[model samples]
Target: MVRHMDERAGVDPRRTDELWLRESERYASTHPRCLQLRERARAHMPHGVPMSWMASYFAHPPVWIDEGHGAHFTCADGIRFLDTNVGDKSTFCGIDPEPVVRAVQRRVAAGSQFMLPTRDALVVAEELARRWKLPSWQFTLSASQANTEAIRLARHATGRRKVLTFTGNYGGHGDEMLTAFAGEGRLSYLGLTPAADRDIDVIGFNDVGALERVLAAGDHACVFTEPALTNEGVVLPEPGFHDALRELTRASGTILLLDETHTLICAPGGLAEKWRLEPDAVVVGKAVGGGLPLGAYGMTAELCEAFERGESLTGRPGELATGGTLFANALSMAAARAALTEVLTPDAYKHASALGAELADRLEAVVAEAGLPWKVQRLGPRSGISFGGRLARNAAEADADEQPELNALLRLCLANRGVWEAISTAGPALSVAATRADVAAYVAAFREFVTDVTGTG
Candidate 1:
């Protein structure tokens, strides 16, 4: 007799290779195109895609998209979806908008990259200053580079070797950022060298006392943070928590680096402008490039001067661990310029922010009616649904439960029913490109799925 896994909160442990294989068999029967493409990808591309993160799309291989426009992408089989996983938030305006597409088309005709600098980069830097109120800026190809560069700037200027971050934080895969806390200590993710272990420190988020103790004892260069913990799965800062953190970092002379790669989905200005956050350095990547690969960091004039004066940690500057050869290529720059200027406007935020709340309400109502033990959390437009009622404030809380069966069921159900989701996020948050009705469609699908799966009569 097959044991029925009791539905609980968090990620369920019912998922194994056998279960996944069974699901894959079923998925392939319907999505023949996807199966064929996945097999093709496996033949050449490791896991069928260049990016491993993309490969980690729950169980089945993610469907390959043919093209995207407005709020959705058309998959290889010509299925148009409400694309919540907009290039994993890289497609800020959803798929491809006309303005961004036109800009790329026009710029492509003119030229792509020239290796020197373009007028767009200058405009982008000025836009950074104007919107973020920071004085200087740098560019790169991905958020990882932006973050690594920020740390380099911090350590160089301060001559401090150590960096600090909260537990359950996701600041990109720079070497220093791999440290996660175990009890009171930090542990490096495997294969990282000894130097990474020595230089990075960890503290618990929203725990002021631990932070104070760490800061007080530290000779640290910078404190890297997400305004709210996002990667360990969408945790938010407690009220006044950020204010206190800012004060503590200032007191300790530790440069505060805010990584806004995911949080930018909330609005045009991101969390810094939205919450009036003040950081010595700000790193933003992903969506800013209008789906192109782009990463950027901004700082004040003083820090820029320190960098210029050779006070930076780079006493011997070689190939920057912070970037690649095509760091600020013109194609990416032109695309970013268009996105920053035209796509991420105030009106878009109003739509997405409002839709985010509505989606949560709908989900909550459906869950309550179904008696499913689940909870959803949202910050502006960035939202997530987990397996419990109490919202997770830390990584531990977020990890307290993992409903594997539910997540898989939900993903397959939604995809089969004509809605697409990340399985990690709440409602893919609303995009400027989304119609009010388009955002609601996911909520409706969820309600229907819960009723159907839970056998709620």
Candidate 2:
């Protein structure tokens, strides 16, 4: 059973709330420029920001980014921060990587889009196929689209309409994946209109028995999930979990589709390659375009053949509704090509892996010394800090470890102290451009926050 937030995690909720209020006031007073901009921009943009999530990023006004380079960025108020956010794991190779920038610059001059295939696109597809060991590839503007298309392909191939996804696993913003299981197995949606009411089902993460039972019904077209649930704070797969999953899926003739959008930071070829877990279809986004918007999905030879048969039977060449006009724009292809070839090389992964281990060790030590229950879980160069001693096995336990007010307090503290953790729910991502100084800054801020809030120094 998952422990409640008030249980085990040694946090004084009242004190933390008080500190959050005090910090919010301090942030508002100090960043007057940001405050003024937020007030003025509210007339134009929703909640004074373009994205809805920006409104909930802070108790006070969100800090507008002035500019970013390498492992750090400056806010609108001229306060520079050591960025552990790394564009919410999108800029995993670091910002403005020279090769990607140069490639995009050249491609932009030649042509942005032409509704025709480019040499760079072919090269990128080949590289992705080489990395993931898949035979065919398709591109989309975002991971959500990639996931949506992958689902469509799975259903078309299997003649099954239902998709089984683990609870708390996020695969973009597709309507089919937007549904979540409320407590007691009740289903709910993030929006008013349900994206998938009858076609999508929720299962337990790492529960091979549950997976086997569901797939045994022979009703699900695909099992869509991340190798590990990163969205809910890094719920790892249990031992022998993948072995059972593969056996069950194969036996039941269900396609296993792994979403590696955020997990791309986990390894050079992402977690699928690192762990030697083979899936019929794979989806990747975020860092694929070297900080630009691009997502790709790779299909095994069998799935590719199935897709081709579906396309032929449909009687339309490009009207499958799987892609948009600018799905594979030349600029995005060029950037992805440079990113896969020049930036995210083996050397880069080696360096980031070492750095991530060190960051996890240091953060864990700090928490231990403070006598806190928090545990730091690292996935390659990225890590998440959970308010529990043991790592979560599923989304329910992962959600139980979350303390929203405490999360806000820590994020505000890190921001105020010159450290930026972009995805506040997860952990920090150490980019290739990140230096020792950046790591030190992050450690220092975490130490200060832990000691201050827990009074353990």
Q: TM-scores for all candidates?
A: 0.91, 0.94
When summed lDDT is taken over every stretch of 10 residues in candidate 1, the lowest stretch is 10-19
lDDT of each: 0.75, 0.83
Q: Give the count of colliding residue pairs in each prediction.
A: 13, 1
Clashes of 2: 1
Candidate that would win on lDDT: 2
Stretches of candidate 1 above 4 Å error? 1-7, 10-26, 181-190, 312-323, 423-427
Off by over 4 Å in 2: 1-7, 57-60, 181-192, 310-319
Considering only N, C-alpha and C atoms within 3 Å, which residue pairs clash in candidate 2?
A: 85-422
